[model samples]
Target chain A: MKGMTIIVKTISSWVKVLIFLFGIYIVLFGHLTPGGGFAGGVILASSYVLLMLAYGREFAEENLSLPVASKLDSVGALLFAAVALCGLCCGAAGFFFNFIQQRWFAGQDRAFDLVSAGTIPLSNIAIGLKVGASLFLIILVLSMFRPDTSTNEKE
Target chain B: MSVPLPVFVAVPLVTAFLLPIFGKKGKSAATFLANIATIALLVLAIASIGQSNVYKIGKWPIPLGINLVYDGLSSLMLLVISVVSAAAMFFSIRYMEQYTAKAKYLSLFLLMVAGMNGVVLSGDIFNLFVFLEIASLSSYALVGFGCQHEELEASFKYMVLGSIASVFILFGVALVYGNTGSLNMAYISQAIQKSGLNAGLGFALGLFITGFGLKAALVPFHAWLPDAHPSAPAPISAMLSGVLIKALGVYTLARVLFNVFGVTIPIGWILVVLGILSMVAGAFLAIGQWDFKRLLAYSSISQLGYITLGIGLGALIIARAGKDITAEQLAWASLAILGGLFHLANHAVYKSLLFLTSGSVEMATGTRQLKHLGGLAEKMPVTRATCTVASASIAGIPPFSGFWSKLILVIAAIQAGFYWVAAIIVFVSLCTLIMYLKVQRYVFLGELPENLQQTKENKGSMLVAMVFLACLCVLMGLLLVPGLRETILTPAVNVLTGGYSYSADVIKAAGGM
Candidate 1:
């Protein structure tokens, strides 16, 4: 597929980075704000989607290849699960116990800080990475199907 | 002994995500890792048996935070899911070799297992739905893994219907939350017990029945099963028929209806009627199928019918007798529940064995059409023998697992004063026998076809998996022995019989927080 018009491509190229940065902000500050990993992930994916729309599939694939995205997806999920498993070893606190919050802050003193919620930000980051890569891959794979022009032309 | 409940969901889940990183060159490594995960799960499930605990996630108290409830029923279900998954994973070691992207297949397989474990252990209704989606989405992908025309078509149909079921379930959950202000099962049950079944709650119950019934593929909601089950590869066929439906569909229905909402007369009869309908319809449909796996798939519906019938009969007895019920009625009710739970375990074993046998046959002969293959008894001795054992168990032949459960159901029906129910039970058994006889005749006993002349038995892990389940099919009847029954089956039965007290019991188990 050919690339879109110059204006569209230019605007998307400029806007995509901002979207990515905004997504990172949402993920990092997810504990205090409404937008968390999933929302941030969508924003991140949409940034790529915009690039794909403007530059075409090949350009986007060149930027973030399929294999890399796939690996990133797995890594993100593993990171989340690894974080959860870490809680299992922490002195009978149970799975997903927020041990860092309890040990460092002692009660709800750090409730309003950026890194206040123990493990939440980390989990959100992992989930954000997974959701972003997964959505990108889904859209990329779905876009692979094109009309069979030769068959249609023959008919 | 204190195997953490989260481990059941975590091991498979982490392994699922981890497998994809191995890529193409690491197929063998991925498979090995996946096998270890499932085996570890099976070991954990065994160790955790006869012990119950409520693990509050993040150590949050019940009613306010998510909890994983491990009780008699969950333990039983976890054991079944682990056994079938372990067998299926082992079988996939060789069986999935024909397909490309074996790592992805294994990943999806583990994902499905993780989802099922989550569903079984989840104490919160909405969390159960999330896990249900995870399992359903993966199974949908697995069903279409072949990516052939028919496989894709079947997967689409399955996904559409399954999504509809999920939507219904989610809507029901929302209604329940709106009505009771809680997503936790224990809290919801308590609220219902306190307020009785209001109109909204009753409607939510209706939605749950429709949703889970669709998931379970009970008669009216069974259009997707035959197509979806046979289209997948054999190990998947086994997993789908063996544990997926029971874990996602029937188990949820039983838990919600019996434990959460508290069974009433109308609801009890609704379940009984649905069970009977599924039994008669599924058996009749199955007997006519020429496709080996399709026949088994239809028979799965029939077998599931027997389970629902047992549970429904128990519910009806309890509902009719009510609080002033006599000891005899209570005994009958417990017997019915015992039959249902026992049949659930028995079916998971034999049905998965049956599907694995079919897979072996399909692999060896390149066809699942019964008519194209015959006289495999000579060529594939192991597959033939194991298939016969599974068929016998499923047909309720004496001394096998199926017989004991069927006997219990019949006795319960008769003692509960439902002679017609007993008759139908016998009738279904007869129909099941005929179907398997047809399978035996067409697939094993007849003249060897020219095309299938060079067929050979599948060996190694596939054979081992088949033989493992076949042995379980034969020995599962021992689970009914008085001493053994006290440990597994009785506690499960007590959970259902306990009814409204489930909330109290769960909260108490959670340290009364």
Candidate 2:
């Protein structure tokens, strides 16, 4: 598919970074806020979707690419699993036990702090990455099935 | 013996994510890793045969956090799932070679396995729904993995129906939670026992039955099974029919009904009616199918009917006896449950084995239509022998596994004074036998087709997988022996027959925190 109008392209390129940063903010502060991994991740993916709509499929793909997105997807899942496994292995607390909260952040007044919720924030980051990459990949793959009218028009 | 319950889910879940990273060139390595994951699950399931434990996720107490409750029924289901999965994975090693993107197939396969394990082990209602969706979604994708026109259509149909079933289940979960103020199954049961079933909870129960019934493909809700099961690749078809319906449908239904709702006469009779309808309809419809896999799919619906009938009969008796359940009544009820649970395990082995044989035949002869094939008993000796074994087992022939389970169901039906039910069970068995007879005569015993004269047996892993399950079919009846029965089957029966006592057991096992 071809790019949209130049105005749309110019506007999206500027707005995309802010949107991505906002997603990161939501993810990092997820443990304290209502919007956590899933919500934040969708926002992250939406930034990329914006770019795809403006600059077209090829440019969007060149920015993140299918392979990189796929790899990131797998990596995100592995990171989440790794965090859970660490909890299982490190402490006698059980699978998904918050070792970081118990051992490192035990006692004291870290409750409202940004770094307080132990594995929760880490898990949020992992889920954010996974959801972001997964949504991107899904849209990219679905875009591949778009009708070939653009190529035909060129011909 | 008390293996951590999460390992059952974790091993496969971790491996599934790790797999696709291997990409195209790493297909063999990915398959090897996937096989190892399934075999590990099998070993763990075997070690956990007679054990029960409750693992609380995140070290949280019951009612506050999700728990994995591994009891007799879970153990039994786990064993069946792992055995079938292990064999199916082995079979897929060679069978899935026909398809491209082998890594993605293996990944989806493991994810389905993980989801099933989670479903069987989950102690919380919402947790169960999440896992149920996981398993159902993967199966839908796998069904259309080949991307053929027919396969895609079947997958779409399956997906739409399955999503509706899931929505119904989620609504039920929400109702139960809203009424009881808890998502933990044990707490919900205890609350129900105390407050009893109000109108809302009663509605939830109905929703649960309809939802799980759809998942189980029980007669009225069984429109998707024939197309979906046949359209998938053979090993997947085996897994879908053999264990997926049992784990996601019947097992969850039984868990929710007996353990949570605590079984009333109305519900019991409802189950009986559904069971009888499925048995009669599935059998009549299956007898006329031309496609081999489609025939097996319909037969799966029929065999599943036997399990539902057995469980429903037991529930009816127990509900009738009420608080004054006598020794004899309890015996009859447990016997019926035994038959159902035993049939469940037996069906898992033989049905999957039968599907594998169909795969073998298809791989060799390039057709699943019985009309184009004949007299393969001469050429493919091993496939014929194993197929005969599975067929005999499924047809309720004596000394094979299916006979014992059927015998138990018949005896229980007679003892409980449900003579009509007993008659129907026997009649279905006869119909099952006739269908298999047609399969044998047309596919193996008749004159070989001209083009299929050079057809050869599938060697290596596929043969190994078929033989493994075939051996299990012959020996599974031994599980009914007194010593083995006490360990493996009896506990599962007790869990169902014990009714609301499940809450007491799970809470106590959770250390009453």
Question: Which residue ranges in model 2 land beyond 4 Å of their true spot?
Answer: A147-155
How much is B235 displaced in model 2, in angstroms?
0.5
**Residue range B30-119, candidate 2, lDDT tens digits:** 999999999999999999888888899989999899999988899899999999999999999999898899999999999999999999
Q: After superposing candidate 1 on the true structure, give the runs of residues whose Cα lies further than 4 Å from its correct spot.
A: A107-109
How close is every model to the real structure, measured as TM-score?
0.98, 0.98
Docking class of 1: high
Two-chain DockQ for each candidate model: 0.92, 0.81
Task: Report clash pairs, candidate 1.
Answer: none
